[model samples]
Target chain A: MTLPRRGPWRIVFVAALVVAAVIFVIPFVWLVSASLREPGYVFSTGLLPLPFHPENYREAFQAVPLPLWLFNSAVVGTAAAVSVTLSSAWVAFGFAYFRFPGRDLLFGLVLATMMLPFAVTMIPTYLIWSELKLTDTQVPLWAGNLFGSAFYIFLLRQFLLSLPRELFEAARVDGASYPALFWRVAFPLIRPALLVVLVFEFKASWTDLVKPLIYLRDESLFTLPRGLKVVLDRFGVRRRAGLAHRARGQRHRHDPDDHRVLPRPAPLHRRHRDHGPQGLSRARSGPCGRRGRWPSGSPRPAPPWSSGSGP
Target chain B: MAAPRRRPTLARREARWGVLFLAPWLVGFLVFYAGPMVASLWLSFTDYDIVNPPRFVGLDNYRQMLADPMVARSLRNTVYYTVLHVPLTMAISLGLALLLNRVGRLSGFFRTVFYLPVMTPAVAVGILFLLLLNTQDGLVNGFLGWFGIDGPSWTTDPAWVMPGIVLMSLWSLGSTVVIYLAALQNVPRELHEAATVDGAGSWQRFRSVTLPMISGALFFTLIVNTIAALQMFTEVYTMFFGNQSTQQRFDADASTFYVIYLFQQAFQFLHMGFASALAWLLFLVILVITVVQLRLSKRWVYYESEES
Candidate 1:
C-alpha cells in the first residue's frame, strides 16, 4: 500500500475502464426495467422498480401499431441497404481497381458532396420529390440509396485500392467483362466491406426518423420512431392515471407515496379494473411510452414533418 | 511484359469500364448534389418559401442572419460540443484500441460489446436515455448516490443537456474505435523494434514512434470527426434538445444552436431565403475551417511514401 509499491496509474486506469463499462451497461438495463414498470409507476418510478408491470409492454404494443411500423422500417432500410451496397461495390471497383480517364476529377466532385450540408439541398430535394409525386411515399428514403451515396463509393474505393491487382487480372484472363468480374470475383472478396455497408446503411435508414416524419404523413405509414413521437408531446390530466396503473403494478418501492409521484389523477385502463383510473387514460393516450418495442416520447411528432424539423 | 500496342487499348478499355461503373454515382451527384447545391445557392439570393416564386431580394437574408443572435449561439454551442466531445471520444477510442491490441482473451468479445449500441435504433437510444437520465428516480442519480454524487436532470437542465449529448455521442464511438484499430495495424514493427532498441519503454515508444506513424489516420479522423460534429443533428434535436419550435418551447434566447436555428428557419418558419442564406454562411464557415486545417496539417501529418 506504500506509495513506492503501489502505482496510482493502475488504480486510475482500472477505475476509468470500470466506470466506462458501467456507464455503458446501466442504461440498457434501466431501459428494460423502465419499459416493464407498472403502468401507474413506470414514469413516476425511478430506474429500479420493485415489481415488473407486464401490462406496460402489453399496453405499449396496443398503443402503437408496432407490426406495421416495424415492417415499414424493415422494408425501407433493407431495400436501401441492398441497392447501396451493390452500387457502391460496383462503383468502387471502377474507382479503386481500374485506371480511368477523369477519374480523379470525377472522384473530387463526388467527394465534394461529403461536405454538403443538408440545408443546401433539403429544400430543393423536397421540391423535386413533390414534383416527382414521390413526396409522401417511402421512395424518398430508399431511392437515394439505390443510386449509391458518394460516401459509400469513396469508402469502398479506398478498400478496393488496397487490394492486390492480381485478382482482377485473373478474372479478365477468363474473358469476364467488368460487370462479370465485379459480380463473380471481386464481389465475394469484398463481401465483408459490403456487410459493413449493409449494417451501417441499415442503421442509417432504420433510425432515420426525420425524413419519415417529413415524408410519410399517413399514420398507417408511420415508422416506429414516428409513432413514439406522439407519446412525447402529451402533458395531460391522464398523467396521474398513467402513474396510478404503474403504481399498483410496480413491485419494488423506495418511494412512500405513489399518489404524489404522478403529475395527475390516474386514468383507468379498462383491462385493469382492479387498478382503478389506470386503463381509460392509456387506452386514449394510445401506444406510447417506456415499454415494448416502441417506448414513449414519440407519439406527437410536431407537425414539422411535412413542414420540416424532425431530421 | 505485354505488347506495346496493348498499352493504349488497355488504358482505353479501363477508361470506358470506369465511366460505365462510375455512372451511377456521377449521375446521383449531378442530380442530387450539384443540382441541389446550385439551386440552393440561387434560392439564398431570393425570397422563396417553397410555395412562392422566388423573388430576388439580393443580400437581405444574409444581412438579417448577420444580426441574428441565435445563429451565433448555435454555432458557439456546436463548437463547444465539438471541442468537448471530439477529444474525449478520440481519447476513449484510442485507449480502447490500445487495450484491445494488448489483450489476448475475448478481444473480439469486447469489440462486439462496445459495438452493441450501434445496433439499437437511434431514437430508441434517445428514449432509453430519457429514462436513465431522469432526475427524480433515474438510475444515474441512484448510482451517483453510492459515490456521493448528485446527478443533474440531464435533458431539462440547459447546462447539463449537451453533456448528455456528449455521453450519447460516445455510445456510438464504436466506429471511431474501429478506425483507430485499423490504423494501429499498419504501424511498422521494425520502427517499434528500433525504438525499443534505443531503450525506449512502452510509453516513450508510443509517444515518439506510434504517434507519428498514426498521424495520417489521426489527421483523417480529426477532419472527419470535426465535420461530423459540425453536422450533428438527429441525436441533439430528436433526443436531448430539439430544433426551432422546440426552441420556442424553451424560447430562442434561452439555449439553442446555429444549425438548429437554420433548421427552424428553413423548415418551420418557411424562411427559405433566410435558411438558404444561413446555409451559405455555414458552407463558408466549414469551407474556411477545413482549408485552415489542411494548410496547418503540413506540420504534423506525415506520410511514409510522400514528399517531406
Candidate 2:
C-alpha cells in the first residue's frame, strides 16, 4: 500500500489519466469547433474553428425558439423535481417510521415498480391523459410526479432508514403531532438526501425527450430536448446543403435567409394527423430525402446508412 | 382495562398517521401505475386505435408480433447494445475508479472532469456524438487517423451502428465511474494494508480485498446498466431517427432499439393495441433478466450482514 509515489509508474499513470480525460472531453471540443465553422466548412475535416462564424448561434436561436424551450424545460424540470422530492420524502418517511401491518409488502411493491418498464405503463398512461384532455399540454409531463416516483421513494426511504429512530421517538414524546414530527423533525434532517433526489429528478426531467415527444405536439410548448429534436429534423439535411455548395465550388456565405434552406413546416393539422398502420406502411415506402432524410443528390454522410467509403 | 384500551388507541393513532403519510404514494400506485398497467394489459388483448373503441381480438397482437420481422430485428439490436454497452461501461468505469482511488492530491479534479459528461443532457450527447462519430470528418475518426486507423462509418453502416451507440453511451460512463469511486472509497483501507502485510501482491490484494467489498455496488450497477441499455432510446433515437418527419430514406435497422419500435407503433402508426403487446413483451424480458441476475448475484455479491 505504501508504494513510492515518485517513480516511472507514477509518470505512466498520470499520462494515462490525461489521455483518458482528453478522449472523454474531445466530443464537446469538437462540437464547439464545429458550431463556430462556416456552414460549408462544418463537415470539413478539421478540428479548428477556421473561418469562424459565431453568427451560427444567433441564427440557431432565430431558426428555433431556443429561449422559449429553455424556459419550458426549466419550469418542467423544477416542477417535476420539487414535487417528486417532497412526495417521495413523505412516502419514505412513512415507510421508515411506521410500524404497521402490510408495510413491508407495500414497500416491496414500491421497489418492484422500479423494475416495471415504463413501456408497460406508457400506453394506458397516455390514454388516461388523453381521456382527461391533457394531451398536447404540458400537464402530462410533470403532473404525474405528484404521486411519488417509485425510484425516488425507494431512494429517500433508504436515506430515511439511516436516521436514528430515537430522534423521531423523542419528538413524539415531546407531544409533537405526527405531522409536526415529519415536517419539523424529519424533513430538515433529510435535507441532503432530499437534495439528491431533487437534483436527480431535475436532471431526468431536463434530459427527458420521450415524454415531451409523446405529449407536447405544440412547438411553443416544447421542452429543450423536444425543441432540439425539431432542430435536428429541420436542419439534419443542412449538411447536404453544405455538400451541394461545396460540389459547386462555391464559398458559402453566412446568410440570414439560411432558414429557408429548411423545408417548410408541415401544416399544423396535417403534421398532427393520426396516421394509422396503412399510412405508416405508405410513409415507409415513400420517397427518400424529404425532411430528416439524407438529401438525395448529395454525397451520403458516413455512418448509419452509408457504406464505409469516404464521401 | 383502561390502560389496555389506551394502548390500543395509541397504536391505532400511529397506524392512522402512517396511512395518512403514505396516502399519496398509495393513490399514485393505483391511479398511475396499477390502473394503467391493467388497462394496458387489456389494451394489448384488443384492437384499439385512439379514435375507436377497442374491439376484442385476443392473441392477435401477440401473433402478429411473432411474425413481425421488425420485432425480431429490434430485439436483436437491443440485446446487442446491452451485451456490448453494459460490460464495456462497467470495465472502463471500474478502471477509472481504481485509478482515481490511487491518486491523492488531484483525485477530485479528475473525478469532476470524468463526471462532467454525465450532466450533459442525453439529447445534446446524441447530437454531439452524431457529429463526432461521423466517419469521414468526425473528430473520432480524425483522432483514429492519427494512429493510421480508418474509423468505420459509425452511424451510417448497419454493421457498425450498435457499436457506435455503445461508444456514445460510454461517453456518459461518468455516473457509473462516480458510483464505483464511492464504493472504492468505502472499501476499508486497512484491508488493503493487511493484505500487503500478508505478502499479497497489488493485483492479489485488489482481487480479494478490493473487489468483494465493492461487489454490492458493482452488482447494483450491472442490473441498473442492463435495464438502461435494454431501454436505450433517447440518444439513439435522436442520433438516427429523430427526424421521422422526413421521407423514408435508407433504413437504420440496427439503430431501432425495442423501445423506439414500440414508440413508432403506438404514436406514429397509432397501433396502440399492438404497441401495448410490444411493451408487455419488453416487461417480461426485463423481468426474466432481472430475476436471473438476482439469482446469480448470490454467488458473487458480498453482503456484510451475511458473514455476521
DockQ of each: 0.29, 0.40
Instruction: Supply the DockQ value of model 2.
Output: 0.40
CA lDDT scores, all candidates in order: 0.66, 0.78
TM-score of chain A of each: 0.72, 0.78
Compared with the true structure, what per-residue lDDT tens digits does model 2 show for residues B1-308? 69868988988988999999999999999998899899999999987766557778888788778877778999999999999999999999999888777765667888888998999988888877776776666678887899999988786667887888898999899989999989988877788889888999988988998899999999999999999888988888777674443223335676889998888778765667888999999999998999999999999999987996
Model 1, range B62-110, lDDT digits (tens) per residue?
A: 7666666567778888888888888988998989876655543435666
User: Model 1 over residues A133-252: C-alpha lDDT tens digits?
Assistant: 886688987897767888899888887877788888987898998889888878887788889999899888888776775566555776766655434422111332232112222332
Predicted structure with the largest lDDT when compared to the true one: 2
| Residue ranges of candidate 1 with Cα displaced over 4 Å | A1-19, A43-49, A96-99, A158-178, A234-311, B1-17, B185-197, B201-203, B240-255
What clash pairs does model 2 have?
Answer: A303-B155, A303-B156, A303-B157, A304-B155, A304-B156, A304-B157, A305-B156
TM-scores for all predictions: 0.80, 0.88
Question: Which whole-number lDDT from 0 to 100 does residue A81 have in model 2?
Answer: 94
